[model samples]
Target: MHNRYSLKEMFFEHLTRFSAILVLFFLSAIFIVLIIKAYPAIHHFGFSFITEQKWAPNFELFGGLPAIYGSFISTLIAMLFAIPVAIGIAIFLSEIAPKSLKSPIGVSIELLAAIPSVVYGMWGLFYLAPFMRDVFGGNGLGLFTAGLILAIMILPFISAITRDALNTTPKILKESAYALGATQWDVIKDIMIPYAKAGIVGSVILALGRAFGETMAVTFVMGNAHQIPSSIFEPATSIPSTLANEFSEVDSELYLSSLYLLALILFIISFIIIAFAKFYFLKNRVKRKKRLV
Candidate 1:
């Protein structure tokens, strides 16, 4: 029995290590390919490719500023709308829901996350875009619409992670707070949130990453206008949306390389955000541990 257990553990350990190596290999390959493919545009355009606003491919004037601006604004809008609603849902599901309803609600939210991005895109294009245009005015297919769609798409991921984090709190903590005459809101605000702050922050970062890289859904509604949006209601194009819309049609090597550069930029931004979140979480955790000691 001892020998069998040891063999099983060794097998799994090796399997896990193999999986990790495979993932690392793939990530390195992607980064290398992007760098190689994007070098032409980088060499030709230099810093202006990212700084200038115009994207007139016909005029050989290509810049990523508008796409980058659109991506940031849309992601900001999504985070603003999604974060509060996700937290509320997570709180209700984890702390307030009745036992009978909790599982169903949680499952429903998870199901939402499982829906494909293209389906969301179709729904947004057919149903949501028209609603926005008819009701609010403007073209409707713009930054605001893209942001709204992304918010809905990312909500389930944030909420599910937050719910799990909140659920990890010790029951004793809540009971002790209650014994101390603390209200439910007080317990949640002061104790629960602080306890799960790192996990919550991580979840937000993940959601932001998703919002930033989202392609199909944003493409359907973002109007694919390669210009800086003057307002939320104006048409715009995100990096992902631009790549999706133009990658197939690119006849110029420079244009193709520029798209690759955009991909690299998106990847770098996500990596930086995740790295920052991890650093912040670790620093806070160390501070808390010192306080406890």
Candidate 2:
């Protein structure tokens, strides 16, 4: 006999559809507003907004190159610092941690990620910033300090996601590695890490996205100088920090338009990272399929 559709499941499915529509609506609204506000600058500057570094508005000259550069560099530094620590945490929790300790430790790490970014900003400003300042001999308000603070802030996200990914690997896959007489390190290095590399990369991308867009946290710790920094010790400004710092107080309409263009660049950066993550995910899926065959 043929089964009829249940009203409850249909209702739930409609609810999920509504939820997705709401999310898309919100995303579209943000993008539309940003583009609408950004068009004046995009029209005026053409392609120079991305390539020119001078941001002064008095001469009718504004550019976002430095802000773009700073955001990229700081996020890069933070991701580099966070990746090793995150991987280590994932390895420990998923591979080596005592069974009894796993749940508590994992929960604590997730709790860290739950902390507000503004709280992190305040902590960085009051505590971590000064500590790094002292350690670095009064030159701490730079990419290094901002990146380090961001690294700590993003650690939980990267670690939690990675540990979850690694933990999801089939138990028999690990057992087979052990059955082959592989050492613990060999099993992890050759078997587990390679298998979960996609998820690990995805986790790292999530953390990097957070670092790239974090406004209050980076603004508080990073010296808000709108210049390209050659050394990590030199003070600089990220795109988000620039918007946070000056968006409200800036006077000219053109000036505000420039900020919107910066926002567009930021949106593009996020889009690129998300695209890369999806590409990697698809590539890994194909590899996994080949392995299964």
Candidate 3:
């Protein structure tokens, strides 16, 4: 029976190792494929493809700056709006909310994440866009509107993950803090947040990553305008939105390749952001843990 258990453990270890390797293999494959498909545009446009804002296919001129700018700005806006709200929701649900209210509120928040992206797009287009236009004084569709929609779409994810993180804090720690005459805010700020900082950071990064890649939800409100937006209320395009809008309409090889290059650029951006968070942030975390040990 001991031998049987050992064999089962060994098998499980090998299976999990294989799964990790498989994920790496898939990531590498996608990068390789994107590079291959985007090579022509890379070679033709050189580095200017990233800096130029023009995207007129009629003139066969393609530049990714507008899309890149829009993507980053929209994501920035989303993170700005979502992070604080998400953290507040997490704190409320984990620490402040009464048990009777927690279940209903938690379920409603989680339900937001279950809604389809296209549904968000529709709602943003018809409802949110008009509201923004009326309130902020711009055409219905623009970066600000898109960013707001992205914030709402990503809120549930960030809140849920952060709530779980905050919940992981020990009851004993809170009790001790209270016993020491610490106020609720003091315990939360000094004890709970410090203890769960890693998870909180992870949740924010996850939401940021999702906001970067959000396509449909952004597309409806962003207007897919291929130009550098002069204002937050001005219409603009993002990488994913550009790809979604023009992929099927490309009439030439260069057009297609440029779109592929845009995809590659987006892939690189997301990979770099996530890799930095995982490697730099998490490595520092490990080093700190070792020092503590």
On lDDT, the leading prediction is 1
> TM-scores, in order shown?
0.89, 0.88, 0.89
Error of model 1, residue 146, in angstroms: 0.5
- What lDDT would candidate 1 get against the real structure? 0.92
**Tens digits of lDDT, candidate 2, 1-293:** 12345777778899999999999998889889999999999999999888998988788789788899989888998988999998999899998999999999999999999999888888888887778778876667877888888998999999998898887778898899899898989988888888788999987886787789888778987788878877777788999999999999989999999999899889878878877877887888898899999
TM-score, cand. 3: 0.89
Model 2 gets an lDDT of 0.87
Better of 1 and 3 by lDDT: 1
Error in Å for residue 208 of model 3: 0.6
Better of 1 and 2 by lDDT: 1
lDDT of 1 by residue, 150-187 (tens): 99999999999999989888999989999999999999
Clashes of each: 0, 0, 0
lDDT order, best first, reads: 1, 3, 2
lDDT of 3 by residue, 182-269 (tens): 9999999999898888778877887787889889999998988999878999899999999999999889999999999999989888
In model 2, the clashing pairs are none
What's the lDDT for all of these models? Answer: 0.92, 0.87, 0.90
